[model samples]
Target: MASTTLRLPGLGWALLSLLLAALFSSCCLASASPVMNGPPTTWLSAPVPAEDTAQLRVFLPSPEARDQFLWRLAGAGVSADLTTLGFCSSRCVDLLVPEVDRQAVEAALPADAVLRTAERNLGGRLRAERDRLAGDAHRTDFSGVTRASDFFEDFRTYAQIEAFMDSLLAAYPEALSGFVSGRTFEGRPIRSMVLSVGGNSTVVDAGRRSIHLQAGQHAREWLSPPTLLYILSGFLEETSGSANLPLRDLLSQFDIYITPVVNVDGYLHTWKGDRLWRKNRRVNSGSNFLGVDLNRNWGPNSTWCTEGSSTFPGSDVYCGTEAFSEPETQAMSQLLDSLPNVALAIDYHTYGPMILYPLQHTYDPAEGDDAAHFDHLATVMADAIRAVHGQEYEPMPGSQLYPHSGGLIDYAYYTRRIPAFTVELRGDGFIVPPSNILESGEENYRGLIDILPLL
Candidate 1:
């Protein structure tokens, strides 16, 4: 462990630069020893344990080079998670690499790609963050506590996020209500929060259109779950004049359903096991991998594992053994099916800082009305996001980014005819700073609502 990370070869000078630039880094990283000790147990070498994997920032020259880079990693028996791989710039991405495989992984990079350490000690960082979990927001004997004192200032556990939702339901019974949509594989409830005029979303009103928004589909995306929670908070605050947004009119015409955490088991695992886990905790039939990427578990049946999804259980982009195979994905799919007139659906994810639309399962852009509608609305939404803090969010068809099939947006658009979207939130990685919670939520919330009235 480097006593101080101050620019030595492979010393994570790049990551250290970010730590120095961030405001909270001074306090949290006062001692600044983000490293762990490991001893070889094999004769030659062994794969780095997943928990100890290091994050690498790789810059590829073009999108084609990105696919080739993934293939190179796959050839070297390495798995890359496409779902949350941060696309920080036009050609830059962040990936997790095992310490033992660093040399081989570097050898596997595209000829023109540039690689640098993003986070050299992932396990140490997660441990340090967990120690700070005492985080002042506890709801005791429960009178009125919506979130932790620093809810917007820190990323929280799934339990705390659930408690926050339940507290809001009790606090504003007339406007907010919820139900357990389904239980996860581990028997944890996948709760859905509803915001409507009368707090009843089980049945859609005669003239109302429904909107579904969810985050935490990929467990490692800690920023997403809280972003949705903050958005929900903004809506609640509006009723009391504490925050002002044009929600009353939107509520009049739409029944909004928000699910903060869908991958309950995997999310809990991140807190106690691996912080970079990107799947639902599913025990595969004969494989060592114990999870399935829920985002890649959606279905059109025929196109389930066709393109960007993987047939291999160990791959980060692995589409489940079968589409909608995981309990969490099934629960969400059914929830969307139940919405009588679902007008739009947004599956929130992280690190691209972009907005994406349908035609994801193939290499073709949406053809007609869907194309125009998606393009226009996505551009408008991206502009709305930039207005908040000048963070640019590119809007494009999902296939352009990557041909990910069985994605939630595709399921909603192709099968249900609902205008679906995916908002890849601000930041370069899953371990986004806690201070980003409020702004990420605010920009995305504003971008979303700004387009609602237009629809």
Candidate 2:
């Protein structure tokens, strides 16, 4: 038998090398555990009682302190629910620790730390609110409404949202357009809608100015998508009716693109399995960990594995293997890149009642008139939101909340040079009841209307 030898081209050898490197990297990442780098500190040695079940609010003086505490908690294998209100500020966090871990956590705190609230049944209160909302939803009557397009009484499922988008396109064939902007890791379509008064435009027209509104980047923020839908409905009504001349004029001048849900897989997961899932469902190659925080997966100024985000695969704010690693984020980046005339972009989040501007990775002001413009627009939007329900929303730099990296709004402003805002709607936390859905939509709609004039 002739000696069997395989001859390979230089490109083939290079490909083989890349494959080996990838395999090695994956193996290393799979076996590597996330380590806490800070100096070790003393912890409470007493065993926690089973009945000591209540959440506590521990306030740290600074972000550094808060981060240190988080690392400590992680190291101790203690679970914590970190709130965003005082994130990067001196009033640095509402840490919800399990009853068993409360003593240990409280003891681990620095002397200057303040206990804002004693252990309370916050979970029970939230559950009660949800139950009440569900009861109200059952009692709601849709007898007079003829079309599915008119349904907006409660929060909708992913299927319902998609169906609603379809109905909008069917109802307004001439003015509204829909497309699968991208797909999630689980192959779910990331749907988007465009509202151009007078005619339907499938492609982005460079000559026409536009504003992009996106929501539901995080799975648990169910209030966001409905708010976007409400805004879309308002635009549709304007296109059909003679009323709201100002809104009609605004619509005529600018095409509005709305992406109701960016993380479809995670959103569905919330409904089907876990209610608090916050990231996109992306399986890590080496580990069994699933999901990547899409907000922490953008580029240019992405401070990966730092401050607000984490290098650990299991973290809630995991930035992913690399910037724009998730297809959802990549699709969004592409969408923004394709639209040159996008003057304003808003990424809606929840529970903070905040209108945050760019530079989330740092406190440094943006170049030229960018900072001024962001501040003006943010203040205008916040004021408009406040006028609706007398609910005051803070309008400030995103860094004021936390030193976040790779956020969508930050990417839009810093890299794309488009003015952007991250609107955290409603103050009732992530689980806003169905009763507040309509009000949240209306309040956000009012704020959105104010945004157009500034744009």
lDDT of 2 by residue, 1-455 (tens): 11011222222222232233335444223212244222111111111111333545567776567656654553444432222222323345544454655666666688887776543655564455445545443333332222233356666667777766776787777678888889999998898888887545676566678788899999878888888887787678766666677667777777788899999998887665355567788987875557788888888643543435555454566678888899999888888777767888999888677888987777777788888898998888888888988877788888777657778887888666877988888744455556566777778888888878777
TM-score of each: 0.82, 0.80
Local distance difference test values of all predictions, in order: 0.69, 0.66
Best lDDT goes to which candidate?
1
lDDT per residue (tens digit) for residues 1-455 in model 1: 21110112343322332234222332113212232011000010111225557888888887767655644453453332211244564456666565666776688787788888878876566666666765543533333443333556777767677777777787777667788889898889999978775345445575788889999888888899888887777767664442444576565577888899999897887776456667787888876656777877899897776665545454466677788888998899999998868889999988788888898777676766878898899999999999999989988888777666778998998778767888888876776667788889889878987888767
The alpha-carbon deviation from the true structure for residue 34 of candidate 1, after best TM-score superposition, in angstroms, is 41
lDDT of 2 at 167: 67
Clashing pairs in 2: none
- 350 Cα displacement, candidate 1 (Å): 1.5
